[model samples]
Target: MGKEILDLAEWKSTLTAFAKERDWEKFHTPKNLATALSVEASELLELFQWLTAEESTLLPQKNKDEKLRKNIEREMADVLVYLLRLATVLEVDLSKALQEKMAENAKKYPADKVKGLSKKYDQY
Candidate 1:
């Protein structure tokens, strides 16, 4: 393997091993993992706190700042890690859950009715 392609199973196993080695499974409850995920998401959002809508959209390329990019990447990794850990702890199939949720959303916001419209499903 060139760089050890990291699929969902590999990521889960890696995370599981890390947690097990540190004996942190006791504290990795669903609620705690969810809270940590939220906190990491907030930290990611803070990176664009002072930027305007347009500025925020172009943050990754327009700024050309490696440090800011790295910070955002790190925060994103944190969020993903927590999400994966939470799914593992809860025995939730992440891929299946994503597919099911996308199907639900498609029904809620059918393309024919919601195309080019930025309205919530209820509003539509």
Candidate 2:
């Protein structure tokens, strides 16, 4: 595989190029990106609206339910695309920021008290 880029600058340029190529820059203002993110997330959630969590998990694998899986995949892509675009617009270092936030959360909720538990950090 080609070298992976972690720099936000590279991602921003990539997003800019994509927008320009498709004449989409006019539609990608920061406000529009935020709105798109919410819309895409709603579409993803619509896939599981009537199903319980257990049913939703199994629906993808049942022969009769492959359509649900396809819907899930499409909505997921929609969400991801807008997320990437939003991240680029905001110049967020997604990987580094995520790792740092996870580390902070680990300190806030240590393993000894939080293992197999769903309690809030303050409850621990």
Candidate 3:
């Protein structure tokens, strides 16, 4: 397994250093990042929002917009920075905990039972 790693502040500092290396600080202004985040998030949401049951399954297969695709990726990166910054401030370990939680959830929602099911765990 990869090493268990990265204090929150470390991730934040690393991200800041990366941005600085590329002179991305000006482009990464908090407000602009926030706006980009919102726009990117909207694109991700557009993937599923207001779709019919069948359409939900087909959306990803349908033609995608360049703007929406780029926005979604950009926004997700923006969100990650803010999240990392917050985690740094709070001194939390995001990656390890997330991996553990996902493992726990997979056990709870096993593929054998959930493969074709839509109801939540409580409903299942």
The candidate maximizing lDDT is: 1
User: Measured by TM-score, how close is model 2 to the native structure?
Assistant: 0.79
Instruction: Give stretches of model 2 more than 4 Å off.
Output: 1-15, 60-64
Q: Could you tally the backbone clashes for each prediction?
A: 0, 0, 0
Tens-digit per-residue lDDT, 60-94, candidate 1: 69457778888999999999999999999999999
Q: Is candidate 1 or candidate 2 better by lDDT?
A: 1
lDDT per residue for candidate 3 within 1-124, as digits (tens), equals 9997646666689987887799876676556666665666675677557667875565355364555556556667666776664454445687777899999999889999899988898887
**Which structure is stronger by TM-score: 2 or 3?**
2
Error of 1 at 123 (Å): 0.7
| Superior by lDDT: candidate 1 or candidate 3 | 1
lDDT for model 1 comes to 0.92
Cα deviation of 81 in candidate 2 (Å)? 0.6
Ten-residue region with minimum lDDT total, candidate 1: 55-64
In model 3, where is the ten-residue run with the lowest total lDDT?
Answer: 58-67
Displacement of residue 107 (Cα, Å) in model 3 is 2.2
Q: Which stretches of candidate 3 lie over 4 Å from their true place?
A: 1-11, 16-64
Which of candidates 1 and 2 is the stronger one according to TM-score? 1
